[model samples]
Target: MTDAIRVTGLTKRFGARTVVDAVDLRVPEGRIMGFLGPNGSGKTTTIRMLCGLLTVDGGEGTVLGLDIRTAAAAIKRQAGYMTQRFSLYEDMTVGENLDFAARVQSVPGRRARVAEALDRMGLGGRRDQLAGHLSGGWKQRLALAATILHKPRLLLLDEPTAGVDPQARREFWDRIHGFAAEGMTVLVSTHYMDEAERCHAIAYIAYGKLLAAGSVAEVTAAAGLAAADVSGGDPELVRRIKALPSVETATAMGAQVHVAGADAAALAADLDRLAAEGLSWRPAPANLEDVFIHLMARRPDPAEAAR
Candidate 1:
């Protein structure tokens, strides 16, 4: 599969601070690539560079078969970007917002395009309602409709479902999948592990660096982490287990306690002792959350490093 986005040593600097250090990324055509990282980890910066919304201070890449450095204007015209926050005018009605977007994008048949977008997003009934009056979910839909008003081949979504409800998030993802099915490339930044798993592949960045990039199963397997879920363990037992030298993470999942570690042999020895205290455990597979947390721990924050 051809890479819809391919960059090598992609770098972005803000003044003296290198917000996006030398990083490389590749997203296959027509696939959703999840951008995962903690806040201020340069995910937004990397994405902006990919779509040519921001200038590349240093690096080389191609987006949509055009050079990123010189073809930014053309890239912007073809790519759709939805910011993390709702950016449409609140005073405008849904229909007005979409219509205005159509005009801004210079879309042909503005009226027809706006009507189609309204129906596509299921906002036909609320087209006349003020954008501010819509719920979070509806607001999300309006943003997406406006983003794709001109039918962009590349979609860059920055935490698009941050505060939306579960059902709404699911519905939004369904639409995303639909677009991908039709050969639209998507790169989305999200904090939700479930959302990351839905993507065809994921890239994890931290402290201006790209640490992990692969399919969910591949990334999870690369971490070399082991875990065990324990039942019949009290909250105090969880606390005691977490204090063990070999334990990396000990989290409670309702009635069960999940623990993971890098030193599997040591961890097993520790757990075996705890099992005598009425705790029952079976080796559990390492999951995305476990891998995500491990990656986060692997990188030290730049601020912390300076201090």
Candidate 2:
């Protein structure tokens, strides 16, 4: 089967500034593809280009089997996009907004579609409430309802869980899984590591570059970071270990110092020596956040992208 989304050498620029640089990506059908990057890393720009909301400056890709350059309108029609900000009318009631969306999408049985959306999002009882008066979580629910009202094949979510409470984020992810189980493909961009872990595949972009792409385990393994958990804050211990030639990252976390380096044996030996200095140590799995931060620090500053 054809991938849900496929692109190669995708690049977007504004004037002399390149926002998305020569990125390649593929998302298999019936899977959640997580897009991860720091702010201004061109994640949103790339997603927009894929969904055909914005034309690409230089690149070629197919979304939902449609040529991105020539069939953008068709791709847009087949995709449901939930942007980072709330774009619905605040003056309208919850049900009214959904009704407006269904009508705009020209969905058959518009009234029934609106009702279903309200129920699906658990906003049925608050249907008559003004959207402006709702909390961040409720507004998110409404936005989701509106976006999926047309039953699009592909869902593009840009930081959909931002500013939402933990419980609300959980509920939102549950809904996404439900959609994916039903054979719908989803591409979500998020800053949260938990959210990224929920995806079947993750792509990490930095400075408009595609840094890593794979299952969680695959990416972490590829990072080649050796980590040691050290308890008790010792300025001398940190300084001593950091001074070692092989140690790449030695930083404190709460009462513990997570020391990581490319050489497992070297990091281990350093920790063992620290134990002689009254420090407690244990082997720990290298965290994804650590790997990515290390990756970012190694990249050229994004400010240079505009040059």
Candidate 3:
């Protein structure tokens, strides 16, 4: 498959600090690549560089077949970026906001395009509503409408559903899937594990380094964590399990506890203790959240290491 975005040794530093290390990434055309990482792990910086909003301190690659180093402006023209925060003129009406975006992007047939975008995003009925007066869900719709006002080839969504209600979030994802079906390459950053699972592929980063990539199954398999679901709701039991030297994580989920660790033999011994205490737990498969937690715990903070 042809790649819509491919880059190698992508690095960015702020003064003496390296925010993004020598990272290599490939996003295939017409695919949804979920960018998963903790805050301050260079996800935003990397996205900015890809779309030409920020200069690349180091890297060489292409976005939509244009040279990233020299064709930044050209790249920006065809790429739509939606920031984490709602960024639109609150004082302006929904229709007015979209019209301004079309004008700024120099979109052709501005009137028709803006009208089409408004309808597509289900904002046609609310076109005259002041942006600031809209609820969180409506605001999200408006932002998305503006992002696609110019019909960009690549969509970069950075935590787009952070504060959206569950129903609105689902509808937004439906639209995203529709765009991907029409062959638009999408690279979205999200903290929600369920959203990440919806993506065609995943790229996980921590401490400025990529720790995992590939499908959900592949990443969880590579993590190689031994996990179990122990049945118990007692807080004291959970606390004791957490204090176990070999147990990496013991989280209470409703009436049960999900536990995991890297060392099989040692962790099994801890489980045996819980079994003797009349708690029942069976071996379970490791999941995406478990893998990410394991990854973060294993990676030391660079700032802490420097000191």
lDDT by residue (tens digit), candidate 3, 1-307: 8899999888898998888887788999999999999999999988988998888889788999988889998998999999888899999999999999999999999999999999898898999999999998999899988998888889999899998999999999999999999999999999999999999999999878888999888999999999988896477778888998877888888888888999888888888887887888888988889899999999988888879
The better-scoring model by TM-score among 1 and 2 is: 1
Q: What's the TM-score of every candidate structure?
A: 0.97, 0.94, 0.97
In the predicted model 3, the residue pairs found to clash are: none
Counting clashing residue pairs in each candidate, in order, gives 0, 0, 0
- Deviation from native of the Cα of residue 16 in model 2, angstroms: 0.7
lDDT of each: 0.92, 0.89, 0.90
| Sort by TM-score, top down from the best | 1, 3, 2
| Best of the candidates, lDDT | 1
Candidate 2 positional error at 94, Å:
1.0
Flag clash pairs in model 2: none
> Cα lDDT for residue 211, model 3?
87
What lDDT tens digits, residue by residue, belong to model 1 across residues 1-307?
A: 8988999999999999999998998988899999999999999999888887789999898988889999988888888999888999999999999998999889999999999999999999999999999999999999999999999989999999999999999999999999999999999999999999999999999888999999999999999999999888566878898899888888989989888988899989999998888788899998888887888777778789899
